[model samples]
Target: MIEASLPALNRRRFLWGAGAGAVTAAALLPGAARADGHAETVGAVMDGMVRDHNFQGVVALGRGGRIRTARAVGMAQIAQGIPMRTDTPLGIASISKRLTAVAVMRLVEQGALSLDARITTWLPDYRADVGARLTLRRLLSNSSGAPNPFRAAVAAEPALLQPPWIDTGEAVRRFATGDLVFEPGARFDYVLSNWILVLAIIETVTGQPYREAMRALVLDPLRMRHTTPVAPSEAMSYRTVSPPVEWINPRPPFLAAAGGYYSTAADLLRFAHGVYDTDFLSPTSRTALTTVEVASDSYALGGRMRTVAIGGAEVRAAWETGNTNGYRSVLGHRLDGRGAVVILNNNAISQRTMDAFAEALLRADAGVA
Candidate 1:
């Protein structure tokens, strides 16, 4: 059975910085834990959130392969009164971007793809003028000029916003013919449509569906058995606003490659570690996959990488926050195998509170008082 309780833990190390790109390298370091206590100090804070009903999923922290703290609180299905278990699968939301990026990077390593190549190389029939100028690098970095379709689609065809009618190819075919917000690679402008094209590229090159490809390239090796494209009926996503009721989510196959997977906090912790592992990627490929292409952008392949201050020293870390409908989640991992924080909430809890809980764990692990 899934664990639903937080356990006491003893932390011995902490991470201080994220790897490459706009992040300063000097910030990466590992420090010994403080003598004040074990890493379980954040347990009380989490319990408070549960008591107040501010959260309804899982929170976990660990180093290497060992978990220091793990807890599940609130209802997975409030209507059914089914309590959320630590292993309960919850929508991971946009964190899927990181996974998609990794899948693309794996292809790049196999010589089947290239980062600097233009979209036309893969989707020769793309036929769009912008497609000629947009490169994989730009798409990976969110610097592509593609317009974000999430908001506009909701307005134009709110009813059609469901994933069935809006798969990746459909989204790409719609947006590729549309207009560009600015010149490709002009600067950072987040656009959901970029990844649709990415998913399209993946399919065109590999000739396999997103699910099959993702399983072979990422899920299998990482041992993330429970993470998969969400089926609205199998999961209950809550709304953060007034009514506070279960909200059904749609998973367009194409967008699923970007933000449609449902995963457990435990599985996400495994993914956090997967991003830093070179076992599946060569040294050169791993560097390309994780390094930032711009000096001002924190976005690496899919998530952001940056430096944080701790006890007057810098530490590098890679992290991402994802939300959809009523679910919000955060995964923060240090590169040196020193620390990581994974939290998933189902009630639209404040992201800051989650960050605080995670940072407290990092600090406690680092002996930073």
Candidate 2:
């Protein structure tokens, strides 16, 4: 859902100062600036985003289980005048998939499930004949033929584009009747429907909602106090709470496994630390999280496995991105967690800015020109 009324953004200004180069890493302290004077380059770019664009959020960098820099910029709500802080909660869209994946994997680690098992083994009534033929890995890897549930939800509930909210059950019920776009595992097509089905399976197996399972398996143990599956009662940003004209508020079931998780910069850093430390999954499981099982170049079980180079530095980057209506986010870490960046914006801001910031961090980590 998108508000058609908001003024068109200044594309040039939105991306000003963000370019591909060997800029300083935000993970470094201010004093850590290189003698060549590129160390504080990240801070300058972040400062520019706030001072120039209407960017509002926090940016945190963590390495080796230590938070090197965690700073907030702009206001949480432009009208209410609330300042963004480390603990300021933000809707981290599809990034939520990683959390959901981790929860499901925990069940797998417990011998409660297998990634390759057919969905029919768990939910016999799951619609799509192709789904019965699909395995959990295919779903996680975006190879499942499921179409995005959101598209179907919007088409069915035409009023969903506006504010207020809708019931979660309606979304689920509507989805239960849909069919897959193709036979499972035959090809990779990124679809939110894959995760919604995953959530259904989790509920069928655990006898609890997907949110409850995640809180139990991932959030609690990691002490991610600021992270949860709870939907907000009000808009957290100055931006319109929901899409305009349609005026539909965010509702549960609609959020399911595809989206609907929330967290703060502080909490996300903690999650990064936990993953690097293997606090939630075993060493083998941790390896699986980063290991590339598929060749899509954008997704994995619970995170995205990709690579990017900044200057002369080339590193394997595991990441996930999410957006819903007014939210946009990027969360990913380097292989060693030596460099990780979490950027969340309320509106459809430029992801290129986030990517440029990440490139800068990789440059600093590699200590290259």
Candidate 3:
């Protein structure tokens, strides 16, 4: 069900940190006098979501390098009665694409890979004609024109969802080799094959597995200790809230880079600080990572650059969302480094709803009515 919209505020009245009226109102709210109102506002929205949408997961709000709200509601594993916790790792789905993009940019910064170079430079074993035509930038921006065979194959045969585990190179050779659906870089065509080929390139350039390279390049440095490419055994997803029926989503190992990592809301907030608030990435790489490569999709290298209305002010933010199986997540942070909202849920929720909830949280955090 779609949530009712939050009360509208004047865009010109409330700037991020400069609004006197907002600060005074935040100081007047009960239990928000000491805090930045992030805790109070985020908690209220989360409580409503849990009651209305059966949201079962963790949420963390961050500002000025500190976590203001980190809360978990409902159950992580309903059958076992395992309650959700702020640290509980849940599948982040396509948000992994953002992480993968960061890893690729790190390589670019190190001179290990070039965005404009043909993918064949690293993946010589790939199909000559196709690889020669594709580049790292095209693949990262989802304009490679590579077709997604897994989606069709899984739809036709559900059993294929649990395909045998294959190494990155073998998986790329088998599934990523295909005729271009459109001219490379002419337009955006978001498909899993682009990320699959990206993983192969990372492997070739780094001489390490995708998971290890990512841990070294992004996760470890960001102190995201709870994040992992491998899904946890105890984490169970749900399709509905009324009856709480289980939804078993199988993720083959080869597709980890595309959408198969488990993370906590706190860890994701940590990622936001590292990527947006710190100098973890070089200036050149950071600019490329956030620059919108496709205007139609608002897609940059790994995530989307979005302009959202917050407290009447037009705010540019880095927005990344993931929805696969019964899991859904959102990581939205302002480009100005004022604040961020991270929501991770195991019970299936529509991406549109999740995006709205995240935005509402951001608005409330800023003390906009």
Candidate 4:
């Protein structure tokens, strides 16, 4: 979910200072919190963010294969003042990119696509020089150096900042005229156009709209019923800045596979269950999906990955964030299957706050001090 700001806040990261560091290990670890009362500590932290920061929405913490804390702290909902729930659907900004990325890699694992193949193999009419140098791997890793049309447009025509989500194919074709910033794979360039081309590839290979293909490949298989292109009943959108009120009902279909999807915390967890399960992806596929690329965003095939020092151990984790319009969201999981946290906030919460939430949960699993 690309936020209203096109260029700024380009990648996903948890703000480390602030309240994030205040989370006591006792409040998060299994003994004090998880055993005696799981929701109390984490839920209190959520409340603090709502009280202090602009955190409005719900969070669901899962461990031992079940949801431990499904809590909502604040709300400025426009939906008849309905409260936030675990099922409340909200925009997950660029987090949607991972969904598209996983879908493409799934096809690759199925032998229906090739990661090393030039993007033009599927998009023959694409500008030859540009396409020749662009591979699915580079595109997925955001190192393809594709020109960033969204950023350029945001700079030239501020009015286009909230431009409608047009057809993915059209966006891919139009952006094809753009020049590459560097030779493919030469640097870590996180460009949104890379996924535009990936969307086009999904259509070319699957002969289906990227939307439908995503449903079949990722959502349906995982039974992510709440994850949809259409917004849910209480599904709210917003922007807390100038000339802006509290709520919005944005329909950004043109964002397509890039950042156009509604998802609930539970549904996102179900997605995690699927993506992390070997049955959902082969061993080799999971490695490719989670292996960090050399430079860009610590991005793997679709989302980003990093190792966090928790307690006394290094834990591998996969995480993604969405910040389009007023909604801010985050989802993360440990590779060792310790824990996962999903937050879908309709009100714009700071990335640091969400980071704090996830950090507390992950640290709890490892008995952090």
Q: Candidate 2 at 123: error in angstroms?
A: 0.6
Prediction 1 TM-score vs. true:
0.84
RMSD of each: 8.2, 7.2, 7.5, 8.1
Locate the minimum summed-lDDT window of 10 residues in model 1. Answer: 9-18
Question: lDDT, candidate 3, residue 214?
Answer: 93
Across 279-364, the per-residue lDDT of candidate 4 in tens digits comes to 78888878888888854468787788877778778888888877777778888887788778887777566777777767766665
The top-ranked prediction according to TM-score is 3
Q: Write the per-residue lDDT of candidate 3 for residues 1-369, one digit (tens) a residue.
A: 112332231111111112111122243333735464545565577667765665667776777545665666667777776766666789899999999999998888899999999988998878899888999899999998987787776678665556667677767866788888899988988788998899988888899988899999999999899899777766788897447798887877778888989987767888887887788898888899889999999999878888889877899999999999899999999989988988888888889999988988888778774
lDDT of 3 at 264: 76
The predicted structure with the larger lDDT, 2 or 4, is: 4
Lowest lDDT block of 10, candidate 4:
12-21
* Count of clashing residue pairs in every prediction: 11, 9, 1, 7
| Reference-based TM-score, model 3 | 0.88
Candidate closer to the true structure by TM-score (higher is better), 1 or 3: 3
Winner on TM-score between 2 and 3 is 3
**Number of clashes found in candidate 3:** 1
Error of 2 at 323 (Å): 1.6
| Highest lDDT scorer | 3
lDDT of 2 by residue, 218-298 (tens): 889888877766654333643442232212226455455777777876677677778755566888677767765566655
State, as a TM-score between 0 and 1, how close model 2 is to the true structure.
Answer: 0.79
